[model samples]
Target chain A: MAVAIAEARIGKWGERYYSGRVLQLLERGLIAFRSSTWMIVFSGFFEPVLYLLSFGYGIGKLLPTIDVGGETVKYAVFIAPALLATSAMNGAIYDSTMNVFFKLNHDRIYHGMLATSMGPLDVALGEISWALIRGLSYACAFMAVVAPLGLIPSMWGYLAIPAAVLIAFGFASIGMALTSYMKSFQQLEIINMFLLPMFLFSGSFYPLSVFPEWLQFTVNLFPLTHAINLVRGLCLGHINVALAGHAMYFVIMIICGLFFTTRRLNALFMK
Target chain B: MPESLIHARGLTKKFGDFVAVNGIDFDVHKGESFGLLGPNGAGKSTAMRMIGATSSRDAGVLTILGKDPDKHGPQIRAHLGVVPQQDNLDMQLSVSENLYIYGRYFGLPRAFVKGKIEELLTFAQLEEKRDAKVEALSGGMKRRLTIARALVSEPEILMLDEPTTGLDPQARHILWDRLFRLKEQGVTLLITTHFMDEAEQLCDRLIVMDKGSIMAEGSPASLIKDYSSKEVLEVRFGSDRNQELAEKLRTLCERIEELPDRILMYTEDGEALLGQIYASGMHPKTSLVRRSSLEDVFLRLTGRTLIE
Candidate 1:
């Protein structure tokens, strides 16, 4: 029974390399993510829940409620979906970027993995799979918190969980791709410099219409903008053909980012 | 049919115009230990990487397990085991987990891998430490675990790059004993190391490599006999007085080497050289006679110390 999988022979070396590596990574990734499960579930769900309770409800008492897409919504409803998107982006990028680099250069776990039948593609895919898994967990927890609060206005908001996963996959791929070029810990400061301003300015906390036209266009370039828009659109019970185009943006990013990341991993490890 | 597990003619590798491994030719027959012995920067590791099907050769015919590395790396590597220079053990996993995961990578079933992991942990002498994380283990333990992980798939050919480097005497002896046991089992082994003692102890036959090329190839005893004399007389005239001392002992020894710290007299009989030195009444400090070993043979052929 143990050798049954070995019966279906791998067609070629390069072809099976990624699949084998992913299998190894998936096993290890389970260990890594589950080890930190308590911290992940607590931080992801409560941070947003607290915001909905304190600022959205508590601070919302200070001002008049605004209308979003012809529907008068509470401040809690306004921020709930955006926070889910934020959690997805945060979980994916954190698990894939810094964690991936540390495992690659310092721990040399992948070096040991590479010595086996596993290849570079397996590493990239396994890492991305873990990132997606973490994204889903966070998204589910965030949505569960919001749904209990009666913040979600429509049934379509449930679909946002998988949508957030696709979005997180996009960000995680780019993050892993970027980590490949970093040679030192000092270089990681640049990742923060790039990620922090995107988090603040990508309309995570506010609507994009508040920004100037040129600034809004620039914010649209950030992946978080589309993710934020898609989730926000779903939670507010707003949908249209435009949301399809917005979701496609994340899909394109996923393909391009994965391609670049796999290529970069091959260049660094195979050499 | 007993065939050559490894066959190569002029295998070479270069990294961006820097020739890491110049064109080289060699072969490893079934179930034999082959070695590449050289100092640092001698391309020994690069050559092993090619045979392990991890690194691509620039311009030579190379086949490992009857398949080209470029085309059949995964298939060929499936039947091979590699122990790299540094112990690249998984820090997050326990000693047994390391072996279990490697077995899984070879597409082994979970049940089969569980049994193999237990067997390998015992073979590596890591059974007691099986549940401990690799980071908690000592250097020798980690290295042994790495070797154990390599054997998880029961590979046909095992490649060890500097198997006992940086190991203390006790650890090195333990590793050597394990390697000898593996050899006795008729597992084909290919190894690379700069330690002459290690080579003499573990290798049945070796090829001395230098500057990305093969300098000489033979058994340890044969190489020593061919390049070096039966005995060496160590004479210390003080580092400052080497030239004058050489002039004085010129006719006494067959050949002399003026080292930075001491002078060496290469002669067939050390007693004759000692008698001549005593007759001259030059009682220098520290004189001893010793049998020739692989270090002397390496120095004679490469014209440099192996350890630099």
Candidate 2:
């Protein structure tokens, strides 16, 4: 009798509750995640913290103080937000690209999922949200590492959680969108070619002002630069008009990336 | 007419310029077991995908459970159970977990799915292997688990494509028995296979297809009756001399099919045909007689063997 009731309800539940359907996708993702050991999750937390320890304290004594916005601050304070922004971007990109690519290709996980009540958009949104969850946890872990070193001083730093999620969403959606165009895992080298440049040139290691006049404009064009500037400005209590500009850039980026990702996934999977 | 659970009229599909399924028509009624019998590359799977609503038809109209698939894909799919030709199980998860997650995919509540897994494990005969990862199972077990996963939502129509193509004989019989139970329970089945014995055993009505077109459509027994004689006389005079002896024994039976290894004579009376062949002063190395089957139906319709 219960089986009949469930079967009867199956036909009545589709389309009206798309969120419930997408949530099913997230639930599936978590099921796969649970099958793995905890060692991978622990490792995601420590890589950024290890980088922070190496760069924040190991090199801070040499640089002494740095000027962020108008106020002078310890070198550790200036770099922590940049590290957080990059950490969020890296975590989101790796999850959305490598993990997603494996499931899309070798595992054919989405192929099986789509054969059910789920659609392509459900898969895209579900995977991007899970990547954001991973990115947010890593950002929080990075903050815990640097907070003991007295790096985060401003109350505006509390906004880091949402900011980290926004940055992660911007990168993760775009990464998923790019992966749909890929034919094989061999094309994944393109992601490395893209991210390595953005990581090195997006003002993660230094201020955009350090670049030459023409190079500074090019540096600001990168999404990570906007993420780093927005996050750094908030962490240091340096509120300014440029902060709104960076925030708007990511908002538009998130919308556009999500739009393209949904369309691309539909084409690749729904055929 | 009985209402069809699946209906397709002039349905077609193409990949680039190559036509995969070219303007085929078939209807599968509720509570009936229907099949598409064809060899490899005969466009059977493409038709299955379009019927399953995973692949849209290139042309024509399709309705599943009284709803157009183009407009209500997810809703239509909710009521469908598709066991694809390949088993795409999640290797990272356990057998019970695979069933649980698929139930959730249909928006079944967690508590309901948890209880459902125990019954499904027993149904698939995987109760001992419930906690085992999907990758650790044998091919037959994985296929059974896939079929069980498709049943989690209690679908109205179960589509199995080449369901027993890779299984051993015993495994095939086991899977067939499970599917037979589902049919007896009045679940509509849409199966595609190149195996004639499977079709004869399982399908109530089926279509013979070759190169993207239906050659003939009828029940298995009716098809064999329409396309072939009641019985077949098989005589193997060694591979080298079967062709030479086929001409000598032509008058003994109404029709004789000269294959490479054996000569098969189609006649109404197998015992009389075999005795007449023996009296023809030509002694073959071996002789036997049997009733005609779906294999003969397919061969008569398409001029090609079903197994390829």
Candidate 3:
């Protein structure tokens, strides 16, 4: 009886573009992970931790404290949220772009999946959700480490976990959309080139005020800047209207990313 | 006539200016093994893709199981088992895991798929390699596993595109035997193959295609009878002499084809034609009389070999 109702619902909603079996892809990813190199999966979680230790502690010793918004906090506290946001972005980007590129071009995994009852939307949502899991885990791991160090000063700081997922979602959706247009591995290198500069200059390590107005405007255009600001605002208890803007930025990114990823997958495999 | 499972009329697909599948029409009936026989770039794979619901047609009407594929692609694909020309198995997963995940993609219950796995493994003869990674398997094993994976959904129509293109003769026979069993079990098969022997061994009915158009359509035997003679005499007077000897050989038989290396004489009695050639004082280096095949039919229809 339950199966009948579910089928009826799926029949009505699918419209030949989705089958509501996105989670099955997650199941496949998890099963595949059992035999995959565990070190690579674990490595994303450590990137932020290493950055915190080397930059937060090493630089924190020299600076002692920094003024964020109106509150004066230890140098480690200010940069911790930025690293959290960066890690979420990094994990999501790596999973969605490089890993997805390999699967799309080399493994032809999506081709096999689309041949089943599953549609392009199912594949897009499933893969993006998997990348989000990696992003969410990195955020949670980063929070667990920093919360013990007293880097998180407010109760609202825990919201950064979901916020980190949003950040991951934004980067993942856009990353996948862009990766779909990539014909060669060298084209993928262009993404990395843009990502490195965005990471280094998106006020991840210092204040955006240090850059010229034109430069700051250019940096603000980078999605990482909004991610860092949003995560930093939550961790530092500097909640304001601007944070909503940052969150809205990701909401828009997610929509655009999903739209294009589905269309591209359909065009590439189903056309 | 017996419940058409697939129907197409004037179906066409174009890539820019190149017409991959021109306006062509055919029907596949229930419990029949249908084939699209053509060489590479003959649009057989393109037509299969349209039937598989993975590609949308540029023009004309196409319906699978009485539903328009363009409007019901996912629903149509749910009933299809497509073995693509290339093996797209998940390299990251073990053999069984590839089967497991594929069933799950169709929303099959875990228990049902788990049960189906053993039956398919036995059928594909891959029970011993259940835990083996796809990359670790040999070519034949990989092909069998791909076919097994396609069956995980218990699909209504099994579509194989060049199912045995790259396997050795032994492996090809084994694969053909498995496909033959599926036919015996009443699975509707849609296959595309360039090898004449494979087509003759597997297809119940077929359409010969060249340059995106159907050149001929019939059962293997009927096509051979309609377009070719009962027997063929292959006489090779050396490569240099083959063209010169073809003029004389033509008058001795109903039809003669001058290939680069040999001259083929088509007749009702190949032995009689060879005797006549010998009586005419034409000494050939070697002569053989054999039954005509789909290869000869293709040659007659398009003036070209099927493999070329």
Candidate 4:
């Protein structure tokens, strides 16, 4: 009976979800990343860091050290955490959306992956994990650069790394879910149109309160708004109970996004 | 043959309004090579997909490995391996990595897959190409690698869709040899193909299908025997005047068919028919007598050529 249970546990369909296959996909993803390591390493780490050097030192020198929510904070202090949020969102959304779509359509990688015991759920989860790993890496590097520059106001900023991962995961899951429905390259332009504007206007560069009341309400609906605010709150060492609401928003988004993405992937590939 | 390993009744698959597989029922016994043979759009691949538990059946009593595919797809699929018509290998990975990752999908430990990878590569004759990327391999090598990858889980049944289509004659023969070895090891094979030669070479029992339904079912030899006469006489006349000669040659054969390219006479002995044609003073450009084959069976059932 024990032998039979062991066999059943290690059986075929059960096998696809095993840590071994997940590890293999993770290893393959990391290996593939190595092939283009320079692109990810430079783009993920340097882009946010470059923005810090350029704007924090170059632009912030001209802007007065402003009072944010009653505390006198440097202009760089206010913007660095927002950069962290945007970088995390960028890392997650880009990898999960465009890269996943290319592998699904042109490379036929998902087709090959599905031919194994790995179901659509496994692929969705695996890709999202990679996105979070990438997002966390970028968040850490950006934090390191900003820390030496005295941009981090308190130790609560360390919590921003995991927060960035959650933020990125929510976007990555939703991005992959949306990518599953897209058919043509021309249609992907719509995603760029949506993503770029959200990055520009959704409080990544400025406070949401700077916008008109109506515009603030509109941008509030965007996932990145909550993510940026959460990181910003943490970075400035302002621990507010309202931060729980932001955390809940990302948690809910991750759940729904993962659920929807898995469903969409299965519907598309398991036919 | 013991109880049927695969049993289906009223199995159907409809894509929107167009019915792809319309209510087919069949069972596969253990350790048998069963085939679904048909032309280009015959739902053979769809049927194979349903049996492989990768596609859903709209309505049916379907059981694979004693489980309902609708509720137990992964369970059913775990015991089965499928090679789709196209070679969907991971172009980024080395040939061995393809097999290794596939084995990992079945949740095999790395050490187990490491040993199996070498054995599988040797079996596929890809030992030298193990480290080469999939994009660098030849077409036949890719197909062999696909088959090897499917075998990584050591499945009980293997499903191949058009396993040898588009392959050169030598490659096709080599694939057939490998498949025959698998059969000798008592692994059941369910194959779908439009190629008559492939069906005849690999299938033990086959169902000829057309337009999403089975037209006939029997052993390859029995199918040829039941649907076709012993021999066929091919006659090509000098010109359009061939029609006039065809009119005169009706009395010399059992059944006469006038095709755009040539005339076919289905008879017991083509030599006697050719002699009668010669003695009757009807001259033709060329004539030949050949034994009827699965090609004849296809032509007789579909009223068209097989390769088309």
TM-scores for all candidates: the values are 0.95, 0.93, 0.98, 0.93
Ranking by DockQ: 3, 1, 2, 4
Q: Which parts of model 4 have CA positions greater than 4 angstroms off?
A: A1-21, A35-38, B238-247
- Writing each residue's lDDT as its tens digit, candidate 1 over B49-86 gives 88876777889999876778786656677778889997
Best by TM-score: 3
* Winning candidate number (lDDT): 3
**Candidates by TM-score, descending order:** 3, 1, 2, 4
Interface RMSD of 2: 3.6
* Model 2: per-residue Cα lDDT over B32-73, one tens digit each: 999999999999998988887778788987898887766666
In order, the candidates keep a fraction of the true contacts of: 0.38, 0.56, 0.74, 0.31
Error of 2 at B204 (Å): 1.1
Candidate 3 lDDT: 0.90
DockQ of each: 0.47, 0.46, 0.60, 0.38
**Residue B285 in model 3: lDDT:** 95
Better structure of 3 and 4 per lDDT: 3
**Can you rank all candidates by lDDT, best first?**
3, 2, 4, 1
**Candidate 2 collision pairs:** none
- Writing each residue's lDDT as its tens digit, candidate 3 over A1-271 gives 1123124434576557888887899998798777894567799888889999999989999999987797899999989999999999988898899989988999888889889877899988998998888888888888999999999998889999999999999999999999999999999999999999999999888899999999999999999999999999988888899999999999999999999999999999888
Candidate 4 docking DockQ: 0.38
Per-residue lDDT of candidate 4, residues A1-271 (tens digit): 1112214644554343332245667776776675444576567777887787787778687985866667888888988998899889888888888888888888788777776555677788888888888998888888777898788988999999999998998889888888888898678788888877887888765567788999999998888788888998899988998788888898998898888887787677667
Let me know the TM-score candidate 4 reaches against the reference structure: 0.93
Clashing pairs in 1: A2-B109, A18-A122, A22-A122
Instruction: Tell me what TM-score chain A of model 2 achieves.
Output: 0.90
